[model samples]
Target: MLLVPATAATIDRRLTGRSPVDGRPALVLLDLDQVQQPADEVADALARFGAGRFADVRQLAPERPEAPDMDGLSLLSDLMPQVQKALDSGDASQRQALKAEVDAVLASMPEAPAGRDQPRLDGVLKAMSEALAAEDEDAKPS
Candidate 1:
């Protein structure tokens, strides 16, 4: 799952292809320091990616309450060598053990909060423009 900044919310809006006639992503204590990400960019990557171009994408917000899928691909980020060794082991028991360990990581993620409803990106863009205008106003000599 991708964790990105709220500013890129527009990109996510388009990717989900949900109704823009809704609202916005709620302002939560979203933690994105672990990865270099932005909201819109996250959606763009997902929407534009194809098989093998990007690893499988499954998002699980730590703020939510549901158990995420126990998929090894999700844990591949930190256990590539172990995962590879397991896949290459060819021994059923070894492979099952490795896969199970990774699966636990997926199952343990904190759930995301009830998501902010989808909405048109126009308001944010307008707000940005207005903020810029205000900045320019402040910069002018009195």
Candidate 2:
């Protein structure tokens, strides 16, 4: 389990492709400051000290009623494979067309409410755009 000060909404980023050192499933504990209960506090402390200290920790699947609608984020994730495919084809015109499509989708996405996830989402989107631009440069004939 990874304990981070970041909001829980960004847990996806932390857990993606992560593997446990002991072959157990990885878990992420977010927003340590928000932990309210004594049991949780002890667990958090133990986790911070060392994960190996605990012999058995029950994994609880809790519902996130506060999770924001992430349809735009999902759409962006879906578009990435297509973007890579376009890049792999090495067709300049196709790349431009797909870039335009991405821009359109980005422009059309609704403004997310101001919160912990919003900045992270914006950063991810910006990084994606910048990466595409970089890839475009790399693909150009020298």
Candidate 3:
């Protein structure tokens, strides 16, 4: 009936009866570290109780993987503001040049790890594309 973080301190507290839900029955503690997995752990646990109306299940946390190094993408933090400024200026030539520069920077940089920095990179690209698209729309005759 309770979903909690898979940390040593939390497990210790729960095991020592110090948790707020200590006295509650039908407690299921699960730790999922998979990048993709179904959300049926609770349902499976409940099914196992089988008409007992009460059960307690606990799972130890897995070792966490190290975060991917994003040093190569750090320059983006500086470049993004410049890009934004160029977009706001509404100068087609400047925006085009900046886009080329940004594209070159991105191409030279190392690929981001899946499910980590990819989303961030995609987001930046999307923002740039949207700004350029808006600029194009504004240039069109009414």
Candidate 4:
């Protein structure tokens, strides 16, 4: 008789739920490393990051790695149209407003250790591309 390994059970632990604190935007950053980490370790990181800062977080086993809810997906979906406009119009002012929104989302992350590289979030990339293009054009020595 052949023996087969049993599949791992899914874990769905929510550290925090959606919050409306001061009407500011909420952000969730998944600690990808935690997928393989022990529950205690994952809980510690969640506790550290969710102290009135992060709006939601969860740790799921690899067998069932999935987002807890559609809130984040909804946020990205709503922002895509605005991002498209900013990218198409190449408008600095519009990009600035969108950048502020992105900032609010990033404010949920814990302060990085000194000298650590910052993780680039989406939506900001389009603005960064626009800025770099302008710089390149300026340096063309026309």
lDDT of 3: 0.59
What local distance difference test score does each model get? 0.44, 0.61, 0.59, 0.50
Model 4 misplaced regions, further than 4 Å = 1-61, 109-142
lDDT of 1 by residue, 27-131 (tens): 222343555787567657656774343322334323353363344234344566655564455555665565555455534644433665322232332343344
Q: Which residue pairs clash within candidate 2?
A: none
Which pairs of residues have clashing backbones in candidate 3? Answer: none
Best by lDDT: 2
Report residue 113 deviation for candidate 1 (angstroms).
Answer: 2.6
Ranking by TM-score: 3, 2, 4, 1
lDDT of 2: 0.61
Name the runs in model 2 displaced over 4 angstroms: 1-65, 68-70, 114-121, 139-142
- Per-candidate RMSD, Å: 28.1, 14.2, 10.8, 17.4
lDDT tens string, model 2, 16-135?
322333443345554345666666666777777776545323454433556644885687678878877876887777777777777776676677767535545555566666666767
Q: How many residue pairs clash in each candidate?
A: 7, 0, 0, 0
Clashing pairs for predicted structure model 1, backbone only: 1-59, 8-40, 11-40, 63-111, 64-111, 64-112, 65-111
List candidate 1 segments past 4 Å from native: 1-77, 116-142
For model 2 the TM-score comes to 0.42
C-alpha positional error of residue 18 in candidate 4 after TM-score superposition, expressed in Å: 40
Error of 1 at 133 (Å): 56
- The 10-residue segment of model 1 with minimum total lDDT is 12-21
